[model samples]
Target: MIRLLEEMEQERRRMNELGQALLEQSIPLSEHDELLALSQKVDQLMMQLHYAKVEQTERQYVRGGTNFEAPSMV
Candidate 1:
């Protein structure tokens, strides 16, 4: 899970770099499309990482039998 999170962070950095580069330079038409696709890919990767973390947390909660109780206030 940590590895997945790291990978997702790396991809996000790459996406940011790409955006910066696009703003600083005039890229060709094909390069624009390619960068857009890469951005979309990064978005998808982030979503997958988020879901993986959520699932892992759920599994841990279930396996550990964690109990949640409301506190009583007088």
Candidate 2:
């Protein structure tokens, strides 16, 4: 799990690099496809990290049940 987080962190760094390149106008139009692909990969990793953190927190919620409840329909 720690290894996974480390890898995700590295991927996030790469994503930032791509985004910065785009901002700096260093990336070519031909590379947009690859940049978009990397962006999606970064999104996926972020979601994974988010889910893991949530799961870890839920394990220590302290209460007997859930911490969130869906809004009730009228």
Candidate 3:
């Protein structure tokens, strides 16, 4: 999880740099394939991070046990 967070941050920084370069040159953002690809990669990493956190939480609950009980559906 820590490694994934670091990688995601690195990719986010690269994407920001690419965006700044495009803005400085007055180039259309849509024309940069690398920037778009980076954006998608960052998005994927974010989802992965979210899922990892959720999985970790579930594991903790399973290991320690939760106090709250499920409500009866009746």
Candidate 4:
């Protein structure tokens, strides 16, 4: 899961670079549409990546928290 998150981040950076490149010149109509779609996909993946990290933290907490128990009464 960590590896997957890292890969997604890399892809997001690549796409952002492409978006920036497009801004430096006048691109074709088709390229403009493709850039828009890719941008949306990058945004969606960022949200998913955030949730994945949150879930991972929650799971780790749950797994570690089971080691303690209450004492018995006399």
Candidate whose TM-score is highest:
3
Global lDDT of each model?
A: 0.77, 0.76, 0.95, 0.73
Model 1 ranges off by over 4 Å: 26-31, 65-74
TM-scores of all candidate predictions against the true structure:
0.66, 0.59, 0.83, 0.58
lDDT of 4 by residue, 1-74 (tens): 67667777887787778777876776653568777777777777778888988897788788895434678787
TM-score of 2: 0.59
lDDT of 1 by residue, 1-74 (tens): 67767877887787778777877787653568767777787788778888987887788798986555687887
Best by lDDT: 3
- Candidate 3 lDDT tens digits, 1-74: 99999999999999999999999999999988999999999999999999999998898899986556788899
What ranking of all candidate models by TM-score puts the best one first? 3, 1, 2, 4
Q: List the residue pairs that clash in candidate 3.
A: none
Question: Under the 3 Å rule for N, CA and C atoms, how many clashes does model 3 have?
Answer: 0
**What lDDT is obtained when candidate 4 is compared to the true structure?**
0.73
What's the distance in Å from true for residue 28, model 4? 9.9
Tell me model 2's lDDT, rounded to 2 decimals: 0.76
Report per-prediction Cα RMSD to one decimal.
Answer: 3.4, 5.9, 4.8, 7.6
